[model samples]
Target: MKVVHVDYRINEKINVNQFYDLLVNSTLGERRPVDDVECLAGMLLNSNLTVSAWVEGKLVGLARSMTDFNYACYLSDLAVNRIYQNRGIGKQLQILTQAQLNKRCKLILISAPTANGYYDKIGFTNNPRCWVLERDSDISI
Candidate 1:
């Protein structure tokens, strides 16, 4: 097995451009709003918790989440640079994210289709009750 050296950071002040670049290099860019820098900035600003992995000061992996720090934590985005995948960087990011919350807090997330099996291997259970509301969707009375 190859050992990867990484530096993990929590709530580090990072620029949106770096995030955009990393996302663009990862599979996450496919589902993210990479064309909108404003949206990406908002996403980063609103997130209360973020665990990032850096290699030689370059952004490689990140786990962004929103939480109350006591009850529920929704991991909104988990992205690893394509060149740095399969080196446990993603798993470490999650672990660091979890460490910030209390034991009572539950970590939740909606996995990307291709990442479902990866989550399973990392000890996340499949929950089928998740629902999505698109921007164009309507709320019925």
Candidate 2:
């Protein structure tokens, strides 16, 4: 089989279909709202930082994040095509994402249940204090 060249780029604009495809092709699709195109579009349009891996011009992996470049970075999405998972593309994507952050900024992500072990193996410390308020939920305070 011929080898496809892989390239990594930062802050590249990836369209919704490409984003949806990559998400769905990876395990993340099960947890993401892939059927909602508008949501996916909004996600790509609103993210402040995005690191993507491409092979022969097709998006194969991505790291989408929102950060102020100073204190904290929320790594909202990290996905690699199932076919591309073991080749280090996902790790490289995270590395590129960190390269754009300020020295004091720390990357944070809520691990998908299936990916917890992978994150642990990659030097991520498990933090048990994360909390979330669903979009449809009301504030009680």
Candidate 3:
């Protein structure tokens, strides 16, 4: 399959009704509502940190990251359609995102709780320098 990696600006024009559907079909059992895809896509678009893959004009894979453009980046979602799995689409998405990030940024990602091994194979090692704290999303700003 011929694949291309382009920035999320393309998402705006994609036939994403199915794109959203495929993401919701993730076998990892994470089924997000379509509304969540719309909201997340909007936020990522505005942040200038989303990239996606296309095959024959169809949205086949996607990944998004938040970056300071200088020092830090957090990769949020990395996905490839079920039909396209094992075809190297996911790796291509990561390569594209990393190429955009380069050496100037510290990259971090939280893999699906069950799919931790895949991320490790791609050169991500555990880092002790970071700690995460959770706050309710509804908490006051």
- Which number leads on TM-score? 1
Q: Per-residue lDDT of 1-141 in model 1, one digit per residue for the tens? A: 557789999999878998999899999999999999999999999999999999889999999999999999999999999999999899999999999999999999999898999999999999999998898877786
Q: State the displacement of the C-alpha of residue 99, model 3, in Å, after optimal TM-score superposition.
A: 0.9
lDDT of 2 by residue, 28-64 (tens): 9999999999999999999999999999899999999
Name the regions of candidate 2 deviating beyond 4 angstroms.
1-3
Q: Give TM per candidate.
A: 0.95, 0.95, 0.72
Worst 10-residue stretch by lDDT in candidate 2?
1-10
Instruction: Please give the lDDT score at residue 97 for candidate 2.
Output: 90
| CA displacement after TM-score superposition, residue 74 of candidate 3 (Å) | 1.2
- Model 3 scores a TM of 0.72
lDDT of 3 by residue, 84-133 (tens): 77777677777777777758787777766566777787778876576556
Name the runs in model 3 displaced over 4 angstroms: 1-19, 28-38, 128-141
